[model samples]
Target chain A: MNKFTEDDLKKELETKEYEYGFYTDIEADKFPIGLNEDVVIAISRKKNEPEWMTEWRLEAFKVWKEMKEPEWANVRYEKPKFQEISYYSAPIQKPKLDSLDQVDPELLKTFEKLGISIDEQKRLSNVAVDIVIDSVSVATTFKKTLNEKGIIFCPISEAIQEHPELVRKHLGTIVPTTDNFYAALNSAVFSDGSFCYIPKGVTCPMELSTYFRINEGGTGQFERTLVIADEGSFVSYLEGCTAPARDENQLHAAVVELIALDNAEIKYSTVQNWFPGDKEGKGGVFNFVTKRGLCEKNAKISWTQVETGSAVTWKYPSCVLKGDNSVGEFYSIAVTNNFQQADTGTKMIHLGKNTKSTIISKGVSAGKSQNSYRGLVQIGPRAHNARNFSQCDSLLMGDQCGAHTFPYIEVKNKSAQIEHEATTSKIGEDQLFYCNQRGIDTEKAIALIVNGFSKEVLNKLPMEFAVEAQKLLEISLEGSVG
Target chain B: MLQVKNLHASINDKEILKGINLEIKAGEVHAIMGPNGSGKSTLSAVIAGKEEYEVTEGSVLLNNEDLEDFAPEERAHKGIFLSFQYPIEIPGVTVTNFIKTAINSTRKAKGLEDLPAKEMLKLIREKADLLEIDRKFLSRSLNEGFSGGEKKRNEIFQMAMLEPKLAILDETDSGLDIDALKVVANGVNKLKSKDNAVLVITHYQRLLDYIVPDFVHVLHNGKIVKSGGKELALELEEKGYDWLK
Candidate 1:
């Protein structure tokens, strides 16, 4: 029996690797590494957008030029040279198809490598996916029924052409252009992403999902996603990201915005698995994203995420409770391994009377990984009877890995009530021995214990997605558990 | 069924059990009573192959086979059981799943076919009812958040399920109330047979009244200082371990 201590956990968490580092050998048309007015105009023209949409992009670009990169996050990185990054790249084999049958076979094979083959047995039957490869929406399934519900689900490019008025109404309503540095960059150059709108009083019957796979080398992906739930409507959305094996680092900067109007409800879930750099820290993905949502009077919005990839990740999905009796929630599990770094958490802004919010964050760090949780809870003067609760827990897989928590809470309304709690623990030898005595092996026991710790947040995901996320957690911690 | 000769052990470089000798035949029951730090539990831990306790100089024999060579699970597969003094909790693994895995692993080690799920379920139900345990308890995580008495009964339940040739109970009666003590004693008595042996290690004589050991040994300073019939337990109860020390 190996006596497990805090130090043993520290040892195992420090040995992470890049198993998905193999890249596809394909030709792609790409722009030069740099950002300028011409690059933005080229993207808008390539998508064949209307005049107003082009103007919107130009306006956002002007705002981005005035913003500075943020340094508030506890992350160490060589600032990415934006001007040296190609902002657009697309597989040359990709065909401009309007239906699933017209989609190219090679594109189908690409989704297979990502383990999501829409044509092969519909492994995710309950899920309707819109695959975004490089800088375009390759294929979208279950479109007709969703369309019948008055639900507008399509690529933002198509939305800009077909529903110009609606896109103009909510494009930057939740997250403005100058929200932050990464968001500003995303707003200025976001090439392709999903746009969904649930019409008033109509509930989306099935889960909506999308998969983002970055394949073009040196191309910085800027995908923008927007989901809006009108009055008395309900919807649940999920997004999963994976990249082909690549030795050279790929940059991914994306933004997501969600809005729930009066008496509406929305649930958003994400599973991020970009390729972390190799054991020697040679190459991987640099993921920087900003996601936010707003809940109106009698509205509710919940965010659940499982982050298990990226050589360096910096994201914080937050919620703004601005209407009376609105509610907000954030449940997240962020695991980083082998030279990976992450600074992620949530924010809850209480501005309306009787508003409520709940946040639960779980972080697992292994193999020289550095994981931090940064959150904010603010209660405004008008937020009478506002309440908030937050619980953050970190599990260290080894001593070399690090975990930290920084929570900011501000109260202005005397009637508001808030509570915060945090705990840090390592998987002990005694705990492992107890499981092994019952015949479970070391790897399985570690998986079970970590699953138990993250159960609260995992249960918030859609049933099918929750199971997949659990498997991802197991696979991500495979050799790290020992 | 079990034997120990010149069994010397230490923990963290400090000697806990000095030279000790003990033996038990099939169908026999032995009770060992001692004061704190007299190596009452050390003998059980050493025999069970807990890695922390070093066998500085010793030999443990089970059914004429050298027991010191096998791992803890190997000893279990060879028909040895140790009811822990304090059972460890394993969250997220149900008791039923754990016991089934244990039984199947033992079978696998013995080169026998694993029991089918149907047959195993039937076997579990019968043993659970005989021990008067709630069926729902089997669905909960193994020993997690269990009361002291519940933990003890769980140990007995596991012992019954395993049906080992040599069952060693280390202070199983310590934390139990009178009612739970009776339940534990009853379960152990039901498991006794002419083909197996039982060794009970305790610090009090109250437990001996129910199990009725054929022999009572007073362990002092890691060695058996006194050995006699069941009447020895009553004498020790009256005078206590001070005289033996």
Candidate 2:
């Protein structure tokens, strides 16, 4: 193990190539590289949206124009120039394909490289995948199979066209057009994302997923995802993202809203692996996302995320418990290395009697990165006997990294119970030596320790995705300690 | 099996082990008894290749090979084991998994394939039975919330599983009730073999009665001042270290 010194670890960590960094060379119909009311209107026109929808976009644009970029997050980077980003870009030759054979071979090859071959996935797993490239969702697999179970799974664009009443009823009910700065921008220029609806008293028979890829160089991916679970229904939705390597930063601002009616349940999971730039922070993605869920009486919602990429990440997946005896949970593991920055957590709002929420967050930072967990828990005046338990733990590797925790708890009802625990610790030398003396090398020791530290949250993930997230954690922290 | 020649070590400019010389052959048990802060633990740590203790002079050799350039893991792979006085608490890794990783890593270092799951389980059960460990105990996180006796016994359980060429027991008898001490001693005695050796470092002669040492050495200050047969431990117990000073 002498050869595996600190310097060697540093070199190995810096040199491990990002596996999903290759770009597909295909002609794309992209908007001009700028943002304005005309650009937003052009996006709406390209989608052939209804006049009401176009008016909604115009209203969101007006609000976004007056909003200032939020600076309170514990991250530092050059503010992205919104005007220099192309808001809409899609593969030029998008023919309506009925089978896998009719899909563009180049596009199919790109998904194959990402290890989600549509053909293979159809035969192997029951997961229905919606493949979104740049600003448009191109293909949705297992739609016929899902339609049999009375579950609506398709791209949000098609949902607007086919189920216009549902889309219009629930479009901005949870996250309004004026929710936040990035959310307003996403509402104005959002092109395409996944939409899922599980009917009352019917549990979806399979997992639903969306894979987002940023294929175009200068385009920003503004995706809007909405999932609605009716009374007594249950559905699990997964989201994943990756991008090609570039020397200039790319922008990605997304909005995700979930609605769980009486006795319904919704599980939302994400494994984000965007490009994290170079060792010197040359180029990567600026990910600013808004995700929130609403749970009605006797309903439940859970948010599980494994964030291992992005140059700068600012996200908070929140839940609003509005009905009596409702439940909400958030389990997350965020890792940042080599000039990466992440400020993420969750918010739990208890509004009714006997509501409950649990928050477990783990952050790992290495190689001059900064990771922070900022959370909020608010109990309303009428929320009698509401309960909340929050635990935030941070692990640091190398002296150059940083970890911070900011938790805000507000209890209005005297009977409400809230417990919060936060701990910050580094990988101790004694622990490393103990592993070393047991014949385990330092690199494997670090991985084992990290995996152990994150097991609680990883256990919350579904089986297949849990394995993938575990591997992602290992790869992200490879050769980070000696 | 192990030899330390004129070992001189220091930490932070303060000398600990001053010209310490010791040797132990296979099939023998040696006890090093000392008062508090008399450099007994320092010698065990230095021999185990801890980096904090700077060796100012002399050398430690295992099977006639110098261990100066070896890292702690390399030394462990070369068949040296030190049962820590206060075992580390790894909160999530179970005892069984920890031992499996240790065994497989050592095998990998020797260019061998991993032991099959069946064989690993069988070995763990056999060794665990010898130590009288509960099946449920083996599934708990390593040393987290463990009693002092359980920590010591767990260390011996690891030693029994690894079956190293040399095992150094550093204050293993501390914090154990009479029954726990007897069980731990019995476990160590059962594991002793003609091809391996044991070096026990303790402050009192209470543990020497159970796993009686063939030789006893008294360490005062930073040097060994007396060496004799097992009866020497009895004499030292009868008259405290004040006379030795």
- Shares of reference contacts reproduced by the candidates, in order, are 0.23, 0.65
Candidate 1 displacement at residue B2 in angstroms: 5.3
Best by TM-score: 2
lDDT of 1 by residue, A8-122 (tens): 3333344344434546665677888899999988988888888777787888889888888888888887777888899888766545566667776767666666667786524
Each prediction's RMSD over C-alphas, in Å, is: 4.8, 3.5
Clashing pairs in 2: none
Give the alpha carbon lDDT tens digit for every residue of B1-245 in model 1. 79898999999999988888899999999999889889988898788777778998979999899877776767777887888888977655668867776787677677776687789899999999999999999988878899999999999999899898989999999889999999999999999999999999999999998998998888999899999989999999899889776
- DockQ by candidate, in order: 0.28, 0.48
**Where does candidate 1 clash, by residue pair?**
A4-A429, A9-A397, A9-A398, A10-A398, A10-A399, A13-A366, A13-A367, A14-A367, A21-A245, A22-A245
Q: Is the docking of candidate 2 incorrect, acceptable, medium or high quality?
A: acceptable
**Predictions in order: lDDT:** 0.84, 0.90
- Per-candidate iRMS values, in order, are 7.6, 6.0
